[model samples]
Target chain A: MINRIRHILLLYLRETSFVLLFWVLVLGVLFAHFLFTDLDFHQWLVRYITTTQYPVFSIWSSVMLGAGIWITCLLGWMFKVQYAHPRSSLLPHYRSSHLMVGWICYLLIVIGAIWVIHVGGSFYQDTSDKQFAFFVAAVFFSAFNLILGYISWPTFAVVLWGMLCLFSNYEYFILTQILGEFLTNVFVLILTSSALLLLTWRLFHLKEEHWEYPYLFSWTRTSQRQHDALLTTLLDMVEKRLPSHQKHKPLKILRWDVLRFSIYKTILFFSAIILPFYLLYIKALSEYFLSFYQSPFKYFLLCAYSVIVIFGFHLRSISLWGRELLFPMERKRFIKEKGMNLLIQIYLLWLFLFILIILLPYMLLMPEFLMTAKFWSEILLTACFPLAGFGALTSLRDLSPRQSAFAFLGIVTITIFQMMQIKNLDVPILLMESFAWLFIGVLLIKMSYHKWCQTEF
Target chain B: MKNDIIDVKNVTKCFGSKKVLDDLSFQVGQGSVFGLLGKNGSGKTTLIKSILGLVRPQHGNITTLGDDPWCFQESTKEKIGYVPQMDSLYPWLRIKEMVEYTASFYSRWNSNLVNELIEDWGLNPQDRIGTLSVGESQKVSIILSLGHEPELLVFDEPVASLDPFARRQFLKTLIEIITRRPCTIFFSTHITSDLERITDHVALLHQGKIMFCGELDELKTRGNLNLEEIFLEMTR
Candidate 1:
């Protein structure tokens, strides 16, 4: 039985090695940040916890822990495991008894690693008293809910998650305060244990039929409606997220009404204006701004912000132009038409940003807190071209997702650096930057046209 | 020009180091029901895709309906109907919606024929495509391809998933449609018995090359072997 459990655990770990490695990398970064820099994630977390009341530490910590548990458990559940009846094995009760063992092994490693880092230290004891006991109970429920979620209705897990977060947030809850914290946990433990006993019975009572529930731990649609619903959600997401225009449109190469690309452009264009005001609503955002405002990372943050805008602008264009090349008819005409559409979308997006920047002072009703006309001109010229230019420069095959993202960052960084070196938002320097971007954008567009003409699917 | 509906000439398509179609050449004339027989990975699908202009061969010319297969115009596309080996139908839409969406693309769409066929197939138009079984989805794909009443129909393993009843009905439907109007039909299939029933011209594909290309009766008379035996012998 022990060897079977170990074998199952090893098999699962091997299958999900990439996901486990990604999680390990994230944890490694957090640990390294603590070790290398003065910034201790734990200490910072401790500070964040102390600031909020009602055992703010306990509730928030549980929410964080619950999210982690949910993520890991959800990843485990995504993989559908098959049950093989090993004739020689001692564990002969359930067809998927090994799966239960695998889940146990999974929870142990993930939760145990988190405990060693977060709760193992003296800092956890120093942070809050109520947190330690509250967290232990929260994690137990989270694990029980997510795994059992697949076997039963998935909504049961969602409800359990909601209950955990909701109950933890309330300071005046009668159950927690009157029943005492340890007693409340004891009640949940009994509740979970009873549920587990029911689950064990269900697991053991296996049938040769029920193709959907091939394994005891497997997730399957109870009805045709459930299957359709799952598939609809998946297909809708794939359709929406596929980087082409909404409709196939006319046989013409360059029509403008691609719904998907237009949606992002409209959102990004509006957000450039609306996001600043929305930031004002969140008091923490302004405080966050001030923190960066005083820090050395301020310039780096600004560059990142610009890169995000440029990246967002070109992201869909890569798909739009890439898809157009795959069409059976019209080579040159499609290129010319698609190029025009690309320019129009970029120009329109920039126009929205320009209008927002211009109207901001009047909307805020501030006279002294105003920018020069040079600033508006600078915004109009520089913002429109670089993103589209860089987008046109890269092909679907030439650069990977990581490469394009880094390239966008690189472009923004260089543009900012050049502007900073000049130390002026003067007309000539702005115009030079504008011309450079325009020239590059047009040149890249032409280069892409050539590549599109030649490349095959 | 030579009364050929499909003219694949000296087509050599390679994927990286391996050649999928090695100087493969074949033609299907108008009013001929041609069956392409091949083993798995014998480039039957690749050859079909190349003829449809979905795939472009590196070194050769393929002409479909007097137009370049690689750059098939709108008019040329209107005349061709294709059913792929695996139908990639969107699951979010209902059967009615899927039919309508496919119908919208073709200028020569036969809505009456499509509706009649859908009804005959016993498929509920209101049912979402995602709720369909594999055989049902294949039926939807066939209806989509046939709705245009295309002059040249191409199918890659069109009835691989159908049950015995559905397969009989499907083959009956194809025969009924073809009898109504003379059309060029080219399809690849593993079912040799079905091929013998439907096709007049049979082509055997082996190792990216055509080992046999002629009338089914001619091969049966000359070789004195059934299609399954012929296919096995050719592939082996």
Candidate 2:
């Protein structure tokens, strides 16, 4: 039984890359938490039990523990029936007896474990306190064992375990609080025994069906074949329907409409204008911002920077939507059209920011605020040029049809660096940046249009 | 009588240095069923795709209905119906919606014929295309191709997914339609038995060239050969 369990687990770990990555992330997070946080396991538990202010933390912890228990029990149930029953053309009476005996033995082991834990925990402490903790541990162990047994089961085991864990934990927490500790322990004991019997009977019924469960643990071979077949089928279908046509033009008109209809830009404008004021209000409430009237430039710079950053993020998201190819027109035309649409969007975004910056002097009742116009112009010019340049570069790359996370990250990094290197707010520098970007953008568009024209799919 | 509906002349196609379809040539006549027989990777599909204007030949020309096939004008497209080897119905749409959408692409769509086909095929209209079995999806695809009442119907491995009973039914349906309309039918299949029952003409494609293109009965009479034995012998 142990060998079988180990074999299945090894195959599962080998087959699923996500499962391997999940374990790596889990261990990494645990190591980081231990290194940085002053989280003594015992001390944390004591605080969790005593603190009234940390109800959310306590609830979350209880939920996790409860989930762990339910899953363990489900695993235990599945483990007891891991071996395949002999295939008999006719009904066999002896097979039923063997299965019944196995279930009885499994139940007895579980009861024995609970008894041992209960006695051991109470040997050092008072009898009443032992029940709640022991019951929780036993249920957790049973659920885990049942889950392990159902290795061949599809998503059902995982989903069932999750639901059971959530419900059992919530019930335990609420019942312990309202009915006192003793009643909660008694209630859990009754519930656990009933669930075990029901699950055992269900397992027996499932075993009666020969083809219900697959004998093999590893799906690696089958999954690869399925994937290859699906790809081949898709390629075959596409080849038959769409004869390799030269070039796909991006629709300029559609791109403009998408830009005009963008909700992200609106959100960015609001976040820029309102977030700084909200932060200032919070600082005032906390009595953190002393002499706000004297150091207004610092606040202005912070607000402007936040607004610029928000707009930059919004532009990045807008750039992503362009690759959807909403218009089935030629690829070159589509890219050119989308490029013009992006330019229009940038113009509208910059105009809105400029007007907001221009109106700041009147709102603040300070003529000196007009001095910051040079900085605002530099910020706008620096931000817009790079954004437009990146958009053009993306259109040039036209990495549509296939995109990776790394490509998106690279685009973001370029946009941020461009925004960072702005020293002057003079008209010449702004115009020069705009013209340079415009030339680069046009070059990218032309290059992309050419590439798109040549492409066959 | 010059009974040909499709004519090819010194057709050659290459991908880089590797020639996929060499100086291949064949003629498929009107009101006749032409069977394209080949082993895997024998350029039968490439030839079909070329005729559909999906692939351009490097040299020579193909004329379907006496017009350059590669031009693929709407007028040419309207007279032809194509059933690809794999079902290409959009997965998100219901079966009925897919039928309607596909029918809308053709100017001369026969709704009455489509309705009769849906009933005969025993397809549930409300079910989504994604939920269908492979055989069911193929039936829907066949119905879509036949709905337009095209002058030339092209099917690539149409009954590959179907069970024996469904396969027989599908062949029967095809025979019925062709009998009534006398449209040229060109289909590619590995199942020679199915072809033997209906096909009047056969083209054996091997290694990017046609080994044989003639009347099925004439070829059999000359050598007393069945398609399967002939295909194996030629391919081997």
Per-residue lDDT tens digits for candidate 1, residues A66-157, read 45545444433532232212111111222344446645754664465345335433433343433444444444444464455444333233
Q: Which pairs of residues clash in candidate 1, taking residues 3 or more apart in a chain or in different chains?
A: A246-A259
Task: Give me the candidate number with maximum lDDT.
Answer: 1
* CA lDDT, candidate 1, residue B17: 90
The TM-score, computed over Cα atoms with residue i paired to residue i, of candidate 2 is: 0.37
User: Could you give candidate 1's per-residue lDDT for residues B24-133 as a string of tens digits?
Assistant: 78888889999998888999999987887656788989988888865466567768778878775656567887776556445567889999989988999999888999
Candidate 2 Cα misplacement greater than 4 A, ranges? A1-457, B1-3, B222-225
Superposed model 1: Cα runs more than 4 Å off: A1-288, A291-457
Leading candidate by TM-score = 1
Candidate 2 C-alpha lDDT tens digits along B94-161: 77876765554456788998888788778889998878999999999888888878888888889889
